[model samples]
Target: MDVLIVDDEPLARERLTRMVDQLDGYRVVGQAGDTASALGAISAQDPDVVLLDVRMPGEDGLSAAHQIGELDDPPAVIFCTAFDQYALDAFGTDAVGYLLKPVRAEQLLEVLEKARRPNKLQRQAKQTEASQSSHNGRSHISARTPRGVELIPLEEVRYFIADQKYVTVHHLKGEHLLDETLKELEEEFGNRFLRTHRSALVSVQHIQAMERNGDGHYQVRLADTEQRPPVSRRHAGALKDLLQKL
Candidate 1:
């Protein structure tokens, strides 16, 4: 199992590194000291399990976990904290487990076993492949805005909104008005990205949860830190089924 250790303290990172080095079937691929650097490492290394600290200088571990969860294939997060009180809330981030600090070798071994399972790797590979294919197919998307020409990577887009002839790209950062029709982008990346509406083609990975609103319309919780998007009636059933399978 490839592993990454994320902790702000040098001593803590070293300790976890030694533990991972001692394990037979696991290897330490990378380590990071802050949320930004940790995210960079996660993108570059793609480790299977991330031994993460709860408290840090800038963004806390929970905040980083939320970012990681947005990725196409997030590594299994195991919170390593000195306190046990955070365990109950950790599940909201989809953490596989939590290990109290001054961690025991036996406990480390047990969680390592859990993290090394084949199913985890299989799912990760599938997501990686899907993301790669989706990215490859999206190179043709170019949008002309008042500022300049913007190149929209299909993977970065969360959804789109149509207004007559133009479609606006809705991403985590902001919106961009693209020249291509929604149907054109949808046709190119249909297998990897799903058209949740006539105007919207949402990346499957960013979808967090689905809910039936008071008016019986379905809505989707996006991986965005700010807000959730509406799942139009046309694609609501399919989105619900997709969420169930995940």
Candidate 2:
């Protein structure tokens, strides 16, 4: 199998490359540090299997797999990560395999032996799901920053407001600009977030009250924060009805 090794760390990539090199049945075709480069490698090398890291600087592995799922001919994926907590989410992407960090050569070799590409029909079905945004929603939001990747639990996020191309993730710790759009966020976090405006998705847990400002516009107040994102007339009625049910 032609294998593509993707990880943010140079050492991790080199180590996996070396392991795959020693294996008789597989060949390392390319290496990548993040999702963008990985996609490019996938296009250029057309590897049969990808060893993807779960967490990275900007786009995490799961999201990358979700994107990869859209391809007409997608490769089998084997996720690599330090945290075992993401195992379930990793599998949800229909990955053929999953490996923990400090991967054992024997384990990797076994996974390779088992990796099978989905048939054309199966690939089409997965692509359809991705187009419809029906894949399993992520449990935690992957936030990218200058320091490193920060995994924010869904519970900590108060709201997500669209700002031009990016969505602002307002959490208990503060706010971070997420690359995801408001629509995608709403689709992934349905039931957990209530749409107050076209640009805002407020967490149900954080919404404390519905208020009317002096200007007569309605607003949704979030817990532990003074900033209230305006409620649009289109969704105001639905928001009010849902809030009253609680």
Candidate 3:
């Protein structure tokens, strides 16, 4: 398998390269420091798997992945980030895997295998399907501020937190208090978002880890951010099952 290591740090790239070297069936075709070099290599070498860094000097991995998707045969993307939030959006692009920093060799090889034999067409089809589902009735979601029925891009939303009668939409930019309740939003967007707590709906991508507290209560840790949302006891089991899959 042809692999491209895209990261800002030379040591990180070298570490991954060493792991790939030890593996029998894989070869490191190229190494890039930043987004420009990464994209150029993709255009030139057309690697089979791009081990992309979540944070970079110029263009971030997520932005580069969007551009790469425009290619006729884009390589499989496996994100390598020190942070966590990018995983959610990363998977939205048919990403086969997401690895945290100082990646385990076993995990890398496992993801590489999955990337090697995946139904790319089916994954793309699912994205198209999800997008189509988002479009049909999203416009009807009333906004609180005169932001007035803002067309919330389905993928951009980090999560929705219910507060009494209103649910606030949390995203990278900031927060918006939408008029709809958690129940209403969940019914409309349940397929894409997962219910993490009685009062919170987490973007599955933002979830990096779910830990059990001293009292056996569970809490969710968000990627790239420090805030941890406590999981309702009722939803703890379900959230644990979901975390296992991620």
Candidate 4:
């Protein structure tokens, strides 16, 4: 299994990497000191599991994991914290495993053996918990890229369309398919995003026009883009009101 070690302390990362290297069927692919770097490493390396630290300078491991949960094929997160109390909350986050620091080799091996990829439901639960406990919603959306994870500010977003099991975020630059659901996003962003379709939520700020197609289907056009997601009957009236207010 590929592993990424995320800790603010160099000593902690070195220790975890050494222990993981000693184990068979596992390799330490990368290491990061902060949440952003850890996220970039996870996106770039596609590690099977991450040994994440709870406390850090910027975003903590738990909060970062919540954002990571939105990415497609997110790695299994195993939080490594000095706080025993935080470790006890692992089950609520749906983490496969966690280790209390200073981690022993045997404990590391045990957790590795038990680690598994989290499903959509598990990721959602983690994000939900993070949102409920936090004062504000997420400022940026994380998207996986070959080089690393790209942070897209919510301001640049045009719309969110739920395609099958995934929701695509249409932003200023481009679009990214995320593991998040439209409902989750709606709850997260609140009044910022208006439901335009059962499978779509559009940014009120990005609303350019509402035009009817040849089939008499009204599509909500966005700013700085040609893409127009169809509006469903249920949400069309509300969308119209939102546009009028905007």
TM-score of each: 0.53, 0.48, 0.48, 0.49
Q: Tell me, what's the RMSD of every candidate?
A: 15.4, 17.6, 18.5, 15.4
**Model 2 C-alpha lDDT per residue in residues 1-246, reported as the tens digit of each score:** 678999999999999999999999688989999999998887666677899999999999999999888753467889999999999999899798999989999999888877844433244335445645765667799999888889999988888887545689988898998878776776567657776765678988778888899989888999988889877544566577667977
TM-score preference between candidates 3 and 4, better one: 4
lDDT of each: 0.74, 0.81, 0.74, 0.78
TM-score of 1: 0.53
Candidate 2 lDDT score at position 76: 81
Task: Please estimate how well model 2 matches the true structure, expressed as its whole-model Cα lDDT.
Answer: 0.81
Residue-wise C-alpha lDDT for candidate 1, range 1-246, written one tens digit per residue: 678899999999999999889989788889999999998887666577899998899999999998888754467888898877888777778788789999888899898777656445355346446656765564435767677887766567777666646777787557888767765665556555665554456768788888767877666767764455566543565677678888
Cand. 3 Cα-lDDT? 0.74
TM-score-sorted candidate list, best first: 1, 4, 2, 3
Off by over 4 Å in 1: 124-246
Kindly give the stretch of ten consecutive residues in candidate 4 with the minimal lDDT sum.
Answer: 116-125
Off-target runs (Cα >4 Å) in candidate 2 are 116-246
Clashes of 3: 3
- For model 4, what is the C-alpha lDDT against the true structure? 0.78
Worst 10 residues of 2 by lDDT: 116-125
Superposed Cα deviation of residue 245, candidate 3 (Å): 41
> What is the C-alpha lDDT profile of model 3 across 1-246, one tens digit per residue?
678999999999999999999998889989999888987887556577899998998788888888877654467888999888877888887577899887998998888888877433344335436755774546333455665556566566777887545678876656788767676676566656666665678777778888877878677877655556667543465567667887
